[model samples]
Target: MNFDEQINKLIYDWEKHAMPVLRGVAGVNSLAAVALLIYRYGFFLTEEETADLFASFDLIFLIFGMVYLTRLLFQLDRWAFIKSTWLEGVLNLFIIIHGAVNYFFGVKLLLSLSLMFSDANPVLQYQHVLSCYLLLMVMTEVTKLSTHLSNLNIKPATTFIFSFLLLIGIGTSLLMLPASTVGPHSMKTLDALFTAVSASCVTGLAVVDTGQFFTFKGQLVILFLAQVGGIGIVSFATFFATFLSKGVGLKHQSIIQDFLSSEDLSSATQLLRRVIFLTLLIELVGTVGLFFSWSEELVFDSFGQKLFYSLFHSISAFCNAGFSLFPDGLNTSILSDDTTEFAISGMRIDIRRMYGLHMVVAALIIFGSMGFTTIEEVLSPSKIYDRVKKPWKDWRIGTKMALVSTALLLLLGTLAVFILEVDQLRHDKTIVEALITAFFQSVTTRTAGFNTMDFGSMKDSTIIIMMFLMFIGAAPGSTGGGIKCTTFYVLLLSAIGDIRGQKNIIIGRRAISPTVVRKAYSILMFATTYNVFAIFLLSITESGNTDIGILQIAFEQVSAFGTAGISMGITSDLSSWGKVIIIISMYIGRVGTLTLALALSSTVKTNSFRYPEEHVMIG
Candidate 1:
């Protein structure tokens, strides 16, 4: 054999024998990284203990560097391997440079750079950067491991369900760490689980004051859970796998296709990319808008603090997670109190009347709840280009239905809130302020869960209205939950058709399929049944509390099931059993009840046969 051929063969054989062992070592290193992170940040350590942990990190980095070099040496297509793993390559290069500089020159590069930005706590800042690096490494390994999930003989629906469960488990464990809370004691197991589930489900129901109870590290964990949960764990995994692995297997694509609701298998990857891109783009825009929209009276410790607040709220808004750093939600004095004033155009104005932040968040909630499919149909560049080329072409029936229904719902909600709450408005609040608040609440009630007005003090009639809005929820395949707007639209159409004595329900000159109609009603039936059972359980569990009325219980149950985070100020007062019931409701709501049923049901279908028809009594 030629020398090149011999060398290639030698490398191949060596890799075949050595790669598995190296991978096993790498796996251990990843776990060690996780443990180190938890140790370094999740607990108080002595000076010596901290030094030893840093030493361990250096060792881990050295091992990672050696593994990457070995793989590069053995790889025949070295350039291709580096290109595919450019992110890892960059990280390794940074580690090698930092290690060499620290060892030989006695210079802490990361610490120096951090000091340039802020002189305060440079050591802590350096440690945080290292923690972030470790986190990225863990995420990389997780994406690599996720590619193997398709090999398991399980339905996509089952896998999807399990993915959320796994995410919640991890989040719970992370939140239970000592550093996750503000006090000396760690979070209770039940409370941690509830928060984890709430964040993972993007439900926004909190048993504790998020801003007051959780430390920065804890909030970061919650933020991570919310982002992953909002987009879906499966989609995130698949996107990273495809981006980092160069390509995904057909089976993986099929699974992604199922999760993303893509009609074309070949387009699944493209759709995944578009969904992530759109999400980030919208979030970025929202962040910028919020950065400028905050009232001047709201003081932050630093620019970084302000920026973080903006980013956190932006993500929360778009995810419809409804998490806020403020104690009173969007209605807090720092956000919208009437007494807080800001100078605008050389005149002092009530910060509550500014309304810019509320408008931005409301817009984000509307877009987020509209679902990716409808967004793509309306806003995708290719679609826009095509529309420009052919102005006569109309939107798809599904898009039309979603848009029309959403508009009608928003208008109805706004008018109802305005009329019902007119007498309840404070005398000092102006007409414009009341209208703005009404508009904001109307937008948030459907699924966003943000509150500018106090629901606890509102009329019971208004609470009933909000519950109906929550029940309808957002559009299908969106981040928000409930029966879904499309399902509600279908039900409405079916009812109208029946009243008119029509044979088939039609919209936009096309008849919706019987299967589609059946599925819509099935979703409604399942949602209603589940809500009734959950409310009944809550009633039993909360019987001891005389202050908790049926209206509050029913409202809370509906809010949880709809993934709407709004409450009548009784969330913290719930008994342990009541919390557990709400947790299950949030899970069921986030992953549709029909999806959970499919995951649990037998896959085998019974044979189809004809049966004799019989007349039945009408309702």
Candidate 2:
């Protein structure tokens, strides 16, 4: 054969044979690579240890990357990889060059400038950059796997549950590692499990002090879990998969539709794209606002630490995960001087001193709880201009209901909390401080766990009010749990219609669908029944302990069920059974109100014939 013919034959053979083998090997090794990198990050390795670790990783990447690139070089002449367009090939070329440059040259340029101002040494900084790149590669491969999974005939609800459960189980094992805790001995398996569940579920109930007990590496693991849990692992993986593939398959779109609670199958792909971009955008904006809002007096010694705090809290708030790095949450004014001394950053500084930070967090929580679909409707650039031009005509019923309900709840909660706490707060804090705390409490109770006041010190009336708010939670499709505001609104309207003796329930001249009303009732029934059963079990297990009260147990159960994370100061004192109960409740809350019901309930055949009419019991 001539040279051109031989070259063409070689390209075809490589594309048919060599590419898969190389990709398969790299894909398998990518897991181990990621695991090793995570271990290195999760531990407090010394400088020598850190250097040796990355050096090994650097070697592995160098070998595999070189082989991959050499194979690519051979195939580029025939455009074996980039089938669609020349630009794709150019992009591929750029990515390969970038990776080679970073890996081979040992350039510490990326993110090194930020590390220069922080406590991170050059060795650690370089390790971080390497770890990040490795993580990106692993995630890219994993996204491919996830997209493939959608081809199977698994229910989306089942997939959602399995994803969280798997993450929780893995996270539990990771947290139980020796390096995860600060002390020599690892945490109790139960405590580690509890923390893992909390983080994985994005429900902020912790059995241990997050800041004091966990090392920086451990904290990072928790943060990783929260981010994974917050946006959902499935959603995260699929977002990248969609980006890489440039579009989603029909099955993948259906799965994404289920995850996002989007009804329009046609827009499922668009919704997935919107969900990811909007989440990142909002979180970025929130982080910047928080960075500026933080008090100078409470500033961290390192710029990186400050940035991490902003990033962590921003994710936590936006995800509606109440996990705070502060031992006392945002209510630092109540912390004793001795307890406050251990804080390395001003994150735990007095709440009154960081009023701006509180507002920023509150805003983030509100946006998070508003649900992605509602936010898309209100914030989408194309709609925003039209909305301003014709506010009433442009907005959908779902968007309007979510916004109106959210506003009403916030207003009612704020007023109730302020009125109930005014006398007590008036004596203990300034009027403005008390008002801010009340406002913050009002927002936080509904699916956010952050607090400006001690939950344990609140009046019984306030506690009851908070329980109601937590039970209602945020809007449907939001990064929160509970019955959802729409459910609560439906129930309220149903009652109002009954009282007025109207046959049809109407809102803004739109008659409600019986299916929607039935669904809303189903959610309420499931949530109420679940909460009651959980509280009952918790009371039984926790009654033996003298330090905690039944009300506190009930409060904790409600908080977990709501994924609100606020505790009446008894999360750590709970027995093993109590912790398990909270863990299950958190899991249920995060999975959602109707989802849990649907997952457990078997579908039944619909009877074509109508049953005999029967009268129900009187209310």
Per lDDT, the best of the predicted structures is: 1
| Candidate 1 Cα deviation (angstroms), residue 452 | 1.2
Which ten residues in a row are the worst by lDDT in model 1? 335-344
**TM, every model:** 0.91, 0.87
Error of 2 at 36 (Å): 2.0
- lDDT, residue 527, candidate 1: 95
Model 2: residue 362 alpha-carbon error in angstroms: 1.2
Tens-digit per-residue lDDT, 3-109, candidate 1: 99999999998988888888888889999998998888889899799878987888888888888889888999999999998877888999899999999999879
Candidate 1 CA-lDDT value: 0.85
Report lDDT per candidate.
0.85, 0.79
Candidate 1 global TM-score: 0.91
Provide the clashing-pair count of each candidate structure.
0, 1
Q: When superposed on Cα atoms, how far off is each prediction in RMSD?
A: 3.7, 4.1
Q: What is the per-residue lDDT of model 2 for residues 287-344, given as tens digits with 9 covering 90 to 100?
A: 9998888876675657887888899899999888888887778876633344432445
